[model samples]
Target: HVVTARVVVIIVAAAMVVIATTPVRSMTVVILTVTPVTTLLRGECIELETLGESGGEAFCDRG
Candidate 1:
């Protein structure tokens, strides 16, 4: 009984380590893989005031 309990504890500890490390390793890979693709899909963004005209200079077509 004691030996079985020790084996179970060791198995649980190893599983815990695997589970903890899996997502961390996956996250680094996922971020590195997804970041550039997402950025490419997301292009430039012009604010509402900046799109047309503000106090500074005209951006839209004045003609």
Candidate 2:
């Protein structure tokens, strides 16, 4: 259930970028893996990724 929520968040963030006309510096959102790598639910890590300024690619933020 939690992982599902993460996907939803990423979708919403992406949509915002599409709807915005003015150039945005960057957009960030959390996404999750489909299959759990851990037995515990909390083990599902949220991947925080940022979209590139060009709007064609994304890079993982270490911070």
Candidate 3:
């Protein structure tokens, strides 16, 4: 029982490490609906977005 539990724990830890270090490609749309006359943080933004597995090129519409 102890041996099986250890093996399972090792496998789970390995998977966690791999997932944490891996940069998985995914798709998501970022929409910025900010009024021309609004809050102080209305225009500028430091966005960190990701792309899909198909390739590069971020799908964003900053308007």
Candidate 4:
């Protein structure tokens, strides 16, 4: 009975940890996914700007 109770407690604690961290983990995932895209876009914009293209500002603004 004590072992069963311990097992139940461990399961509950693990579940609670998962539930609590889920949002944070998802946000981290989103940031990780988005950062590279944003960086790539920004790099493209900078390249365009360096090339003295008129559309560079517009492209960066749209991004």
Q: Would you estimate the TM-scores of all the predictions?
A: 0.36, 0.33, 0.37, 0.39
Across 1-63, the per-residue lDDT of candidate 2 in tens digits comes to: 467567656666665665474335323211222123222223222332122232212221211
**TM-score, predicted candidate 2 vs. hidden true structure:** 0.33
Per-residue lDDT over 1-63 for candidate 1, one digit per residue giving the tens place of the 0 to 100 score: 345446546655655666577976755655554465334323211332355435212322221
Evaluated at residue 16, the lDDT of candidate 4 is: 59
Q: Between candidates 1 and 2, name the one with more favorable TM-score.
A: 1
Worst lDDT window (10 residues) for model 2? Answer: 54-63
The predictions' CA RMSDs to the true structure, in order, are 20.7, 12.8, 18.8, 18.4
Ranking by TM-score: 4, 3, 1, 2
| Better-scoring candidate (TM-score), 3 or 4 | 4
State the lDDT of candidate 4 residue by residue for 1-63, as single tens digits.
345446546655655566577866765655554576566657777877888888767868877
Candidate 2, residue 58: the lDDT equals 28
> What's the true lDDT of residue 51 in model 1?
50
Q: Which structure is stronger by lDDT: 3 or 4?
A: 4
Candidate achieving higher lDDT, 1 or 4: 4
**Cα deviation of 3 in candidate 2 (Å)?**
0.7
TM-score of 1: 0.36
Clashes of 3: 0
